[model samples]
Target: MPKKVVYLVVLVFFLLFHPPVFADITVVINELLPTPSSGNDWVELYNPSQNDIDVSGWILDDEGTSSDMLKIPDNTIIVKQSFKLFYVSNRLNKDGDTIYLNNGTSELDKYQYISSETDVSFGRYSDGSISWNTCSPTPESANSNCEVIVDPTPTPTPDPSPSSSASQSTSTKSPTPTPKATSTTTKSPSPTSAKLSPQVLSAASESSLILASSTSASTSPIPSMEATQSALSKTKVAGLLVGSGLALIGLSIGFYFWYHRVLGNPKKEQSENKT
Candidate 1:
């Protein structure tokens, strides 16, 4: 009957149009390698999905600056539940540098680090689309308990003036009352000059130099403690969301099947008893 045909058509349409509950690829930044005083940085990518994903032709770039491009090899295939590490050739990006992952056409993920320090971002890629979240830079994401902390620079002390000792000594000398009687006599070179300590001057100069160096390092841009903490929070939330979504979807499917099995079997039994 036409009604049967219409029912079939509706079923077909529903099957075709329904959104899939499972994702194709899940990419996570598993690790950010140690940054040396100079040289390149590496980003580790993990494929958590069951199917293999070919990252060939994929590009990794640093934010708006496209000059630094990492190309995934044509033969590159991220096996199911495996990891791949991509090394970024660019050295320390000044401040506020962003690293982006793309597949020639669309951006897959983006991470921004406060300039001069090592920070990172991560995301997932599916069918040319990117699912991404920003994270505060971490020493490494795989190990959440461990973090990188930049030590505060020591404060500098002011250098003592050479004239201070001479002034102190002059102040201590008693004043002669007869001005004309002592005028013709040769004045003794102050004993204070010979008493001036070489060790004291050397120590003062060294302390002043150390302070100056510390001041310069302190002024250099380093991520604040609060900013680092914020970045970690963001990353943790993102990881939980990505890792939990599939598990939730699986649970939903299992519940749906159980519900149908329970109701359908009970209804069939009642129909047979009526017969």
Candidate 2:
């Protein structure tokens, strides 16, 4: 085998076995409703990964500015190939806007549109095509035809008459005197209610006594410091008396042994001298 051919085989094997690290899943903005009927705008993300991908620390930006970006919350996971709706707090431009989904320095996906319609979502068609258009906002679901969500609240019609002003003045004027007279009457009973407060104070005193007794029963008894000191002093006096008696007995036995050994008996010594 040629040396160059062996080297080529080894290089191919290494390339197949070892791949680059720091790999991340790609997510796209599947649908967006910039002009909703009554709330802040929302954007939906589509994760195509078979496993759940955590999009924590990801940023969604418009115009790629610091003030125009919304950082996704921590532990924000899109379950295996699912959709996640996020509120775009950066105020989506109703006329025309561009949204960019990025992680750190890497741009994952971007969607932009110029022709925006009110309450209509802009996204790709369901025919497996890459073309994006004004479709129904299917948040956390597949994109389809936009539905006309009618607001149930009736539009307030303005009364266009000089009497409308007169009626408002009459309504405002009628409420003023009624409350002041009622408030003065209501304040007189407050002192009467203060007489009832004594009953509440008695109840509170009873509860506090019960609490004190319960706490006292729960506590264990502790020895007094005076008792402990008296016990210690008695032990010391007993030890001292025993030690003094032992010393006196030892001294007497030692004195008798010294006299017999160092001084002779007088009668025995005189008998030995006569012999």
In model 2, what is the error at residue 49, expressed in angstroms? 2.2
Among the numbered candidates, top TM-score falls to 2
> Model 2 off-target regions past 4 Å?
1-25, 127-129, 146-275
The number of residue pairs in model 1 that clash at the backbone is 6
Q: Per-model C-alpha lDDT, please?
A: 0.62, 0.76
TM-score of model 2 (CA atoms): 0.43
Give the poorly placed runs of model 1, Cα more than 4 Å off.
1-25, 91-94, 116-144, 147-275
Q: Where is model 2 poorest over a 10-residue stretch in terms of lDDT?
A: 17-26
Per-residue lDDT tens digits for candidate 2, residues 1-275, read 69999999999997666432233444677788888887778988886655567788888888645674688999887766678999986367877778988887788788877656777887766522366767867889877874333335888999976778898888887845445444454556666546555579899899999999999999999889999999999999999999899999999999889888667577679889999
Cα RMSD of predicted structure 1: 42.4
Instruction: Specify the highest-lDDT model's number.
Output: 2
Error of 1 at 8 (Å): 19
| Cα lDDT over the full model 2 | 0.76
lDDT of 1 by residue, 29-48 (tens): 55443343445666667666
